[model samples]
Target: MILWLTVVQIIVAVAAGAFCLVAGLVGRRPSDFSVGALALVELLLVVQVVVAIVAPLAGNPPTGDLLEFWVYLVSAVLLPIGAVLWALMERSRWSTVILGVAALAIGVMLWRMQVIWTIQVA
Candidate 1:
């Protein structure tokens, strides 16, 4: 995984998480902005997936356990999707908070993935 891309993902995820958290705390329901932020995160994750697949083919394989990295990647992709679905169905401020939590989780997971990709020993 690329360091810059991972950093970008982390930054975006954290920012989105913060935005959703603040909105939810202020009694905001699930809205377009909140959902859109998650959508953006999802888009970035999809990009990351593509990069992960292509990076190895390009001779930039991870130094960590490939299986562990894949598990984290897959889970990170699924999280926001699940959160958005929950927000849509529940349509409440707490659901917004869930979205925030999911985004934040993704940020941490992305960081872990970065460590796994570049720092950890296989």
Candidate 2:
């Protein structure tokens, strides 16, 4: 994974998570802003997926276990989708908090992925 891309993903995920968390704490429902923020995170994950695929071809394969990295990447991609679906169905403040948690989880997973890509020794 690209260092800059990873950094950007982490930043976006944290920002989205914090935004939803604050919204929930303030008793806000699952609004467009929260959903949209998750959508943006999802989009970045998709981009990261593409980068992960092409990076190896471009001579930037990960230094850690490929299976582990892929697992984290796939889960990170699915989390926001699941959270958004849950929020839509539940339509409550707690659902917004769930979204925030999911985003924060993705951020942590992204950090692990960066480590797998650049630091770990397979």
Q: Give each model's whole-structure lDDT.
A: 0.97, 0.97
Write model 2 residue lDDT over 17-83, tens digit each, in one string.
9999999988999999999999999999999999999999999989999999999999999999999
Instruction: Put down candidate 1 lDDT per residue, 45-105, tens digits, no spaces.
Output: 9999999999999999999999999999999999999999999999989999999999999
Q: Which residue runs does candidate 2 get wrong by more than 4 Å? A: none
Cα deviation at 106, candidate 1, in Å, is 0.3
TM-score of each: 0.99, 0.99
lDDT of 2: 0.97
Once model 1 is optimally superposed onto the true structure by TM-score, how far is the C-alpha of residue 104 displaced, in angstroms?
0.4
Q: How many residue pairs clash in all the candidates, one count each?
A: 0, 0
